[model samples]
Target chain A: MSETAQRRGRGRRPAGEVREGVLRAAADLLLSEGIKAVTFDRVASAAGSSKMTLYKWWPSAGALAAEAYFAHSEHQLEFPDTGDIRADLTAQLRSFVRLLTHEGERTREGTGSVLAGLIGVAQTDPELSAAFSEHYSAPRRALAVAAFEKARDRGQLRAGIDLGILVDQLWGACYNRLLIPDAPLTEDYAVALVNNALDGAAAR
Target chain B: MSETAQRRGRGRRPAGEVREGVLRAAADLLLSEGIKAVTFDRVASAAGSSKMTLYKWWPSAGALAAEAYFAHSEHQLEFPDTGDIRADLTAQLRSFVRLLTHEGERTREGTGSVLAGLIGVAQTDPELSAAFSEHYSAPRRALAVAAFEKARDRGQLRAGIDLGILVDQLWGACYNRLLIPDAPLTEDYAVALVNNALDGAAAR
Candidate 1:
């Protein structure tokens, strides 16, 4: 076997398997050490892949980090259809806050820090910026929107309500706290967000 | 007088004057060139001050950038209490959206970009992080909170409302769009955010 082939698992593993390994390694780095730790060299070494392979798959480090974050968060961030919008929203947001903060026995440690770093770097990197929205935010937001639509159909929500604003209020508030961090991003805060947003702040 | 004194205009400029000039120069670089261009070398040359002076005033590049952003935006981001909560919020949000987007005859080209860059860098920079919240976010948030309290006093808002969520819902949505950018952060969107948060989405 060629040295290159031997280096890349002696041509034994499938390309898809290799890619998954790469993503797993990258996610581990992101969750453990934050975004700055997901370098080409580190990810390549961790995944037993070459820098060339990483470059071929992702346009930039930020892009790779973005995908890694989505991969790591995909299952954990799903909205449950419990037929109660308030309960489901409250549960989902609590889970999200834990994921961003001090979740136990999961992708803890630097998850929020990693996310903040990815967001920070995305401002300047076009490929990373697009990857973040396409891979993560858009899909995640669509899930919330679908859940809200179901609730609306079931008469849990008011008619003529903009579902997008619902997204901006609840989830966007978390993002604000994550980015700016002037207030505590606790589960209680999440529950308060859901309740207040649904109940309205106007005096009846 | 020594050559060094002559170079700095023979110490003709006061320390306060030098600091103000440095801030102006840093803000200009941030607005026009984004965060990367506001290095000590670049800022010192632009402000006609020494790198030592910049370091004496600010701990890091991110720190300087944070203060510069606050200095530039102080006048533009104030909340006006026009006696009507909805109108006041809508106007404030519209103005904010314009500031982040394409307003003419102002800091038009890259205000949002600079803010995004600052927020991004602050994630990894302790000095920048503190400076961002201390100089920009905390003070700015205080302005909004005061206005909301006035409206609450006037019985325009429901009692026992979470004011932080109000800030998050309106401005946080703006920040979310700026960061994740799945949808438009337009004036219409801003108005909708304000109206919906006040009116809410309950079927009752």
Candidate 2:
């Protein structure tokens, strides 16, 4: 009957829907522009919402960025289980490299521009840090752990070789490559990673 | 004395000396405050100099931080050539872990914090990334490579083992720990790295 009702009838959305829209906008910003460009104002404008709506959902920009980063990457780690350990590992490691290097180029851009800015902010903000650890690091870690466990179950891995260490080695290799851009994460290098870590190799 | 001489007496000293002072201050800031806090303004103030002086020495904060990080860790790696590969590797890996994890509680703090921050920055900055490769990553890689080389020479390592992957596995093990704060970089684990990489114990 009132203007609010009239606006609602004219395609206005509820507050919950507005929050999802804002989050989606933030994810788009992270993928396209990076974390630095995903501000509350920008997200609000892009989602046809207001700053108050964003503030109501996220306490800080870092929190919002963390959520956005997670949203962008949530569907990323669907590791397929092939019958062969070697084949599956090779494919998975290759995929990991691409995700960090080629496929996830935008996240890399955001790392320096927006993610770094958010991380700087996160260092002082415990809530954001916790959120980052939970959303970003945990999921990836779980995926790697699952991969290693599967490998072990297939009798492709050694009994004493720690799954935790193996997971770290796989992810750490990619992290190192991304962190150091000049060092190419080539196909040869990816092959070597699986051979040395998964299959095992001579020390020298 | 001329006005220039008067100014020199108060502020201007040998440019080299001033530059060294600024670098030293930058190192202290990097160690104390983490990488995000190492700004030209902070470095200049800490060094008791002007921003212009700091800028003249290092073009950017990343440059300054890289130089400072290397300066602090300038000790050339001592690769023990003991005939026993196992003993030699154990000693070397122990020292590596010590350097990486042993300063104080702050030792882990410094290495992990600075490395994570620098790697993130180096993702986009070509110059810094190169410098990081040359000064930081190269030396560590060289040490790992050399250790493998020594093993190969002694016939302790398998002939077909890939040095590139070998290096990644070793470093990746350490790095994985750094990224995952819950796990400890233990000496036994370090030994396991050498053993597993050298003679794979995969379930097969």
TM-score winner: 1
Candidate 1: Cα lDDT at B55: 85
lDDT of 2 by residue, A1-204 (tens): 999899898868877777778778888786677656778888888988879867887887768878877776533656778766777777877766655444444454323344444444454555566677777666767776777787777777766577777765665665555554435676667777777675565543
* lDDT of candidate 1 over B85-140, digit per residue (tens): 99999999988888788743435653677788899888888899999999888888
**Can you tell me which runs of candidate 2 are displaced by over 4 Å?**
A1-12, A73-75, A103-129, B1-10, B73-76, B103-110, B124-127, B180-184
DockQ, all models: 0.82, 0.44
TM-score of every candidate relative to the true structure? 0.92, 0.83
Q: Please give the TM-score that candidate 2 achieves against the real structure.
A: 0.83
Q: Estimate every model's Cα lDDT from 0 to 1.
A: 0.85, 0.68
What TM-score is obtained by chain A of candidate 1?
0.87
Model 2 C-alpha lDDT versus the unseen true structure: 0.68
